[model samples]
Target: MKHCLVVDDSRVIRKVACRILGDLRFETDEAEDGAAALEICRRQMPDLILLDWNLPTMNGIEFLRALRREHEGKSPVVVFCTTENDVAHITEALGAGASEYIMKPFDREIIESKLAEVGML
Candidate 1:
């Protein structure tokens, strides 16, 4: 199964994403902040990343930038799942190496479609 890392500061969001990814047959892991997520990546880079924008220690953009700078970072498909819905935010995320973007208040259907679009499903 493909491994997925859900990075969000909200415990609820992380739990929800993990559960959805799990149901989709992905091996799931989660981190409450970007720093923690980066640590996890250092140990094991996941096949996909479901990321949130605002986070403690390190924000999503910073994490994406840092992750892309790593040796194996470009291998993982980064998908920004966040409340930041501005065109600029989306542009920045995509420019920073995110493969896709999802707005907040997402459900299983949305997640499924987005994953499929990124060819992760």
Candidate 2:
């Protein structure tokens, strides 16, 4: 099974993503912030990351940049899960090394479809 790291400050959101990923056959882990997520990346790199844009210590873009730089060309496929629907925000995430982007208020269908689009299913 594929491993997925879910990064979100909100516990509810993290749980939601984890459940969605679980339903899709992913072994999911949760991170409350970028710091924890980064540590987890260094320890065991997940196949995919579902990250939120708003975090306490480091935001999603910062986390993505850090992961991208540290892992070089072998980083996990990162998907930004954010409430920011602005195109510029999405572009920034992509530029920072996110593989895909999804807006917040997501249901299982959306998350499942997004993962499928990335071939995680």
Q: lDDT for each of the candidates? A: 0.93, 0.88
Off by over 4 Å in 1: none
RMSD of each: 1.1, 1.0
Per-residue C-alpha lDDT of model 1 across residues 25-108, encoded as one tens digit per residue: 999999988999999999998999999999999999999999998854457999999999999999999989999999998999
Model 2 accuracy (lDDT, Cα): 0.88
Task: For model 2, name the residue pairs that clash.
Answer: none
For model 2, the run of ten residues with the poorest summed lDDT? 68-77
| Candidate 2: segments with Cα more than 4 A from true spot | none
Q: Write the per-residue lDDT of candidate 2 for residues 1-121, one digit (tens) a residue.
A: 9999999999988887888788778999989889999999999999999999999998888888888878877358889999998999998988788878999878888887887787777
